[model samples]
Target: MSDRRAIPPHSPPSPCVNICVMHKTRDLCVGCFRSLDEIASWGSMAPAAQREIIDQLPARRQSLKRR
Candidate 1:
């Protein structure tokens, strides 16, 4: 199942940083990782808006995950 929801004309942007830090337990970044606020905000973002943020995630996440 997905966490799809309603979106408005404007949506929040990506929360990322060039400096990444992967958490040992979560296998996610300690730095530049999405906060609870961002996740909550996602469902209200447009598809195109979500895509824009998502596109940068994989590379950034992968870079951290690799370390």
Candidate 2:
């Protein structure tokens, strides 16, 4: 039997829900709640930066709900 351990994901999964529309006034993706710059930079961003953005998603979604 081989001793194997599950490997963790290399990077944070994207926030894209494939609903790729941008909010006109808010300047955030209505689905993922990320700004255009954030979206564009996602692939190049470090894991920590990615996590920071992910951490903000809930609050961003909540704020959108208030609109």
Candidate 3:
């Protein structure tokens, strides 16, 4: 087996469900909740970067909930 355990698997498809809208102020998506730049570059970014962004989502949602 390879020694690449630190990397995550390929990104999963967007669960868009046709609800494509971005958060105007934060440049995040109200639907998928990813930042616009993140969404745009999703296909090319490496798994580590993707995981870093994915890791922020829950906190973002919590911030939104507080507002």
For candidate 3, the lDDT comes to 0.73
Instruction: List, residue by residue over 8-50, the lDDT tens digit for candidate 3.
Output: 5777565344667876677777776787778889889887787
Window of ten residues with lowest summed lDDT in model 3: 10-19
Query: Residue by residue across 1-67, what tens digits does model 1's lDDT show?
Result: 9998875555445565654655665555566654445456778777676777677666766766676
Cα RMSD for candidates in order = 10.9, 4.0, 4.0
lDDT tens digits by residue: candidate 2, 1-67: 9999987557799999999998888999999999999999999898889999999999999988899
Global lDDT of each model? 0.62, 0.92, 0.73
Best by lDDT: 2
Q: Each model's TM-score?
A: 0.41, 0.83, 0.69
Model 1 CA deviation exceeding 4 Å by range: 1-33
Which pairs clash inside model 3?
none
How far in Å is the alpha carbon of 34 misplaced in model 3? 1.1
In model 3, the runs with Cα more than 4 Å from the true position are: 1-9, 12-17
The clash numbers for all candidates, in the given order, read 0, 0, 0
Worst 10 residues of 2 by lDDT: 6-15
| Candidate 2: C-alpha RMSD after superposition | 4.0
Q: Judging by TM-score, tell me the better candidate of 1 and 3.
A: 3
